[model samples]
Target chain A: MATGNISHGRILSIQSHVAYGYVGGKAAVFPLQCLGYDVDVINTVNFSNHSGYGRFGGSRASAQELSQIFDIMDQNGLLYPERLLTGYVPGAEATEAVTALAQRLRHRSPKLIYLLDPVLGDSGRLYVSPDVVPIYKNALHLATIITPNWFEVEVLTDTKITDAVSLRQATQVLHQTYHVPHVVISSIPLKSWLLDLLPAHLHPASASASTSEHLACIASSRQGSSSTVYATCFPCLPGYFSGVGDLFSALVLAHFTDEPTTEGETSLSRAVSQAVSKTHAMLVLTHEAAAALPEDERTVTDEELDVREPIRKIRRMRGRELRLIQGQDIIRGTQPIEFRRLQAWDTFWDA
Target chain B: MATGNISHGRILSIQSHVAYGYVGGKAAVFPLQCLGYDVDVINTVNFSNHSGYGRFGGSRASAQELSQIFDIMDQNGLLYPERLLTGYVPGAEATEAVTALAQRLRHRSPKLIYLLDPVLGDSGRLYVSPDVVPIYKNALHLATIITPNWFEVEVLTDTKITDAVSLRQATQVLHQTYHVPHVVISSIPLKSWLLDLLPAHLHPASASASTSEHLACIASSRQGSSSTVYATCFPCLPGYFSGVGDLFSALVLAHFTDEPTTEGETSLSRAVSQAVSKTHAMLVLTHEAAAALPEDERTVTDEELDVREPIRKIRRMRGRELRLIQGQDIIRGTQPIEFRRLQAWDTFWDA
Candidate 1:
């Protein structure tokens, strides 16, 4: 199971690609490369920009196209990667293709660390085709780790997460039922009532001031009958960001792979803490960069205002793109900001 | 015309992408991003591995598809990149599309820096569609800078460069006749006779040991009637390397854009010197990595021996892939190897 250096190992990242802005592979690939990974990217959909823009152009790579790429790599002895990262597959057939590919990769290298970011949708909606839900659900067992936002957790587990208890219940389903070795719920926006349900130590420092403003991320590792969970919380920045989740998943893969042999709470905590801290730093930079843009570039158009659109009103979504290029130093670990540390929250989940 | 920082500027990079290996955009994009440019990539071809692998999988992005991407970017106001880089377009139609895109970009940003790498062929053979030659020729006037290998210069200017004088004559055709302000003949294999034809200072030190063992790159910049030229020479390493030319072109774009205002010999000299030096360092690392592979991985197959195949004889192409992931520090300029320096060779070109 030990590869001498994880950086020397290759990562097969199947994700969407956009020419204009960061999302999917465009967001994830550079950061992984910055952290020293030879990333082999399979672009599921190549577009002009992420769909957050009111308009976008380009086509999705069909399931057949995905198989064609896989066949060629197989022929050339290039199909095996030490790590597999799948994000943002747009349809059922594509999602199935990704799952099959993951199975093949895992079969070839039993030690493969498959980090599946189940990008079904966000904000209580399923942006992906409904048919893909079962496909992702079936694929969970193949993953070494899964990074799902709370909405995705609810969708996959078929549970309503209203409080700490229900949230842990859903996580338990993923761990005990599905047999996912580790699960990292990427983000959780806390409400006052939900914050109060948790023990006081589990609360984000900012939750005392305004609970709704705090975002917390939970990481759990399952070992036999019991599971270990940890949480990190930070004040949420107000802005639209396209690839923060993709970046977070990529960084987690990097850190987790760096400590590949260690698979329990400590490894998960360190990986989640570093990823959360780095993502927060990038988001803060993105928000500030948007604020620094010229008034004209940062203004909402009358059409957007008329529709009362959230995306367009946030400065045409132009000012809101992730500032990955400017934050290269941070990604390279040269100028890292250790903004937040993960705190053990096993008690909250147990209670 | 004044962009606050070149790094903050967006670069529209059109190239090929291989899923399993580094070549085209896979090779160029990460290095450029490491250098801190927000590179928006339009992949002209997406393949499983580079063509050097003898077998490949995937499809070329069509000219119409390229146009569709451009239209969407245009509609979204994402087309006005401060820098435009064109490389390794596989067809006449795609090359024409790239030229049109470059024209549109320059039309929008009159001060845009367009670095065009006419990736037609290498080693006296045309790897791309032969019909693409004229399109690249027609597209030359739109380029702010062009990086062409010696073979490409012969094809473009319709001149045989047997000696330094003929080489300069061909460079003059690109500069004065074609209105290309900056021309970099990326690599020159100096024969003993050709080396003698040049002034002594222009010769690489390794030239004295074995003239054929050294490689040199020439950079030239034109202003009105006169053009200034600089040359850097280094010992050639033994290896079958893919994407070395692509990497060279990308580094030139990064350094030249970093010094955009002064677009003459000094800037061109610094750009080419840094590019050549950095490329040399990466190549040295690549060669060492290939040599360090397991003996079985580095052995030539009997079938290849029967055919006397140059590619297979060099070891499995696996050993030869660019170590870009491990060389991230070098790409980031954090661990630079200033292996060579550019020398003013105006006299050699003048003679």
Candidate 2:
């Protein structure tokens, strides 16, 4: 309210709500709000915690319930949100409902930017129902910005990404096939040569050469202009983080919505850069906290690190959650953005 | 995570979550998170917006579903949250489930603090089901802190609060009969005589003589010591505002949990003072925003300002929501707390 003339953008975020841990809406909403967006979250699933803990509690909201909520919003004449973000829709029905909602919202508000986070799975598999892939692919046309990790990209485009060239090709194919103006691949595995080509400071000494690190790439293409792709590689974190993608999507959207595309600065690239920098800072904070845990609580065995669980074993062993609250200052910009921007094309594999 | 020695406290908040408005958990969770607490929220109902717009859509979680969620948390060994909060339980079954959950959590962790916001009604009428009142009364013993408005106090204690003396007596009865150590009467209507007893500067020039204003009071009793009661008065902003109570409860809990009851500062009074100050600032922001709207959008007919609707007409008239995100800096303490602590007893009506 202190902001007199400056209008805070409204974001309607549809995602999961975990009572305990940070995932989906729980992870996304806070950061967006911290960044000064008026965020309205529609949780597709309400659980006691993220399911990564082997056992969890809560219920997935029925599509009918979602429709009812949407209807109510419509009745209240609250249909036109500045932006709409969809994350972690549980099943085919939820996916259909969300897609329909997005399309209707897009029709209602032409400027309503849709940021779709395709949350199928990480690694080379599908954690969600097989039916969800086609639904996501179909929903891609509605999204102004699409954020998918490597595995989701593969699932959506039906292409394997073995190296940098293939990753660029896949991203290109996504733009050509789906007409998505902005594509942000959240975590693409980096090859050894690519890692060696980068600056040494990017990789911490603790990061071993044997393990693959990840690069988050953002690609934007206009109709007549050549496309610009920007990418940044971060040190391979020791643990699996469940809500990092959600956090990234939220931050990117926040930046994009907060600052419009100007002649001097490409808003998409700037947004991605800011988001990656913030996420890297948050991960460093998370890693430091995990490393500081008592020895008895520090190490998690391979068996306990179940692939089925959404969170990583190391996180469970350390604090069993993302350190969102503790690292909030970073999210709010009180802590400076420490991660530097790499030359946009220099890190691009195709270049 | 950056705070090496400080451990962020955890709060399990059970409340309603509106997708498009600030009320219940939607109003509570972000402020607590902004203050650096790791908050887990269980939403009782997921409405599109607050019901104050004459219509709303959402489904309330059944008791069975609530039990299932609790069972999952218990199975995962996550039942020992440092604090538990309950707000806006839609039905008796949900109330019973929450009470049981609180008792079980309290048993698991004896140090667990339960802050119960008895969100039954305000301004002398019951908005919720009548059955919820008895359930709330039965559950009062399980709470460490109970925040209720004047109407709720009267309903719970079966007494009329004509003046400050009666209000104190009612709070004492709550402590004696229900064993609640902390009783915070959120809003007590002040009489004209009481207003004259206060310093003139506390009341703004716009606050007319005929219109009644409210004061927020906190009464705390220790086992062997006499009770300490504190009160602060503010000009009543024109228009109805929902979620103010939920926001107050959250800020109080955040402050109380953040700072222990040390010798130099009474944590209860400090928490109440801070919460009152923050709420007043937010209301001021809300009033400014509402007043800035075009005249056509400014006025809400008296009939439209229904007491059954939890939020204010001004909010609905302008943005159709509370200005929670706009005034978030106050919630995060970046903005200075402006309202000072009034002479605790000068504002007392009986004096």
Best by TM-score: 1
Task: Enumerate residue pairs that collide in model 2.
Answer: A1-B326, A52-A310, B240-B312
Cα distance off (Å), candidate 1, residue B131 = 1.0
Question: What are the lDDT scores of the predictions, listed in order?
Answer: 0.82, 0.76
lDDT tens string, model 1, B56-93? 77888999999999998887777888888989887889
| Candidate 2 lDDT over residue span A24-87, tens digit each | 9988999888777888789899888786776677789889999888887876667768999999
Which lDDT value does model 2 have at A23? Answer: 84
- Taking the tens digit of each residue's C-alpha lDDT, what string does model 1 give over A266-310? 787887877898889888888888888888657644664726754
Residue A21: error of model 2 in Å? 0.9
Which segments of candidate 2 are over 4 A away from where they belong? Answer: A1-7, A193-211, A214-218, A222-226, A257-265, A304-320, A346-351, B1-7, B193-211, B214-218, B222-226, B257-265, B304-320, B346-351
